[model samples]
Target: MKDQIRSFILPGGNIAEIDTREVKACLQALMKREILIAGICAGVDVLDHAGILCDVKSTHFSDADLVTDKNVITARANAYVDFAVEVAKKLNLFASEADLQETINFWKHYQRVQ
Candidate 1:
């Protein structure tokens, strides 16, 4: 199960869901695997509740769009693009630096790809 997962993404939604035993257990399992875990907006609170944000630098709905520390990536409520970009970068999805920059330019900067 854990071995098959490359990353775990928790999207912003009902914060109360985090308190459930099933959610907690799943988070704990992923934490032990040390896989990439991303929490967007209110989702950051979920990660915090899971005790995975300890000693980790994270920004929750802050001025900074995205913050990536170790295997964790966090982002503000309105920073969906930044969050996706950081996760793609962490996963090495781009073939080259130019590809990454192009992606950023097109998505983040809203520039036309040339």
Candidate 2:
């Protein structure tokens, strides 16, 4: 499973710091190996701190602009629907537009229910 890791997903949070060497090292390794790294909300700050978003177009919590560069994709906290759909697309998990639309519709319904 470790050898086949295709992506690293960092959940959203109010992270105050991300300078820990170990965490940085892990991110560095992921980038070196071309593993997709995704950060939601404040997690995007972590990626930015790791220098992973140097040239990568990315978005974060409270900022709705979307960014897609290299193997990274980011979106604001409230845009999780878009974020999730983009992530699936990046991973080539959706077989067709219908499949992707279904996912989007599901999430839209979930949001409405909430």
Candidate 3:
């Protein structure tokens, strides 16, 4: 993991310093489309650091231990959805009907590559 971190940093990839221990940075990065974001189990913790979550609704419990700012809607259970919206809010990436349409279009195109 540190090696991966080093590579991204060596390139100075405009990456933000996010606490990966809880998934905050990862989610924020994805919301902004700064980095292609995906994770499982612990990796999702990094997104939590950026104030995001995963398929939280499916789980009644979590092991994450991180936080960003003081206030905002947080993941009650399903973090992926919450995080996506949060990312949109952060980048001003999604808002209104047009914003939703744009997000859907972007995701549809994005998933094709993945």
Candidate 4:
């Protein structure tokens, strides 16, 4: 489901709907300073679980509050969109215009799913 959106939103950006099971390998790529991302919902959970959001302030859907896992980015929503703009704004700070263009193209491609 999410990959469909990722494919459309990132056209030529090498968008990947990496499975949580492979997050360890994914994290290696993410750790590189050049990698920019916008993780949401389970995606956010994966990053938090991996100890990357510890100090970033992201969000999740669980009623239970999160613990200080890898310092965790305290998110503001249970749903993906809640942190979307925030994440995008952050990504824009580093990504190129072409990257954003590809990202939007990917989203436009997937918008039909809803």
**Best-fitting candidate, measured by TM-score?**
1
Cα lDDT, all candidates: 0.84, 0.79, 0.40, 0.43
Model 1 quality (TM-score): 0.84
Judged by TM-score relative to the true structure, which candidate is superior, 3 or 4? Answer: 4
In terms of lDDT, the best-performing candidate is 1
Mind sharing the TM-score for model 4? 0.38
Query: How would you encode candidate 3's per-residue C-alpha lDDT over 1-114 as one tens digit per residue?
Result: 422421011111223443434345434544554343433334343444444444332111434422223222233333554456554554456558687777767765765444
Question: Residue 74 lDDT in model 2?
Answer: 77
Candidate 3 lands at a TM-score of: 0.26
Candidate 2: clashing pairs of residues = 57-67, 60-76, 61-77
Across 7-30, the per-residue lDDT of candidate 2 in tens digits comes to 887777866655467777798789
Find the 10 residues in a row with the least total lDDT in model 4. Answer: 6-15
Q: Deviation in angstroms for 50 in model 2? A: 0.8
**lDDT at 18 for candidate 1?**
65
Please report, as a residue range, the 10-residue window in candidate 2 with the lowest summed lDDT: 60-69
Ranking by lDDT: 1, 2, 4, 3
Q: On residues 1-114, what C-alpha lDDT tens digit does candidate 1 reach at each position?
A: 557988989889778856667886788788778889999988898888888788778895346778888888999888898889889988889999999889888876675669
Q: How accurate is candidate 2 locally (lDDT)?
A: 0.79
Q: How does residue 33 of candidate 1 score in lDDT?
A: 83
Distance from true position, residue 36, model 2, in Å? 0.7
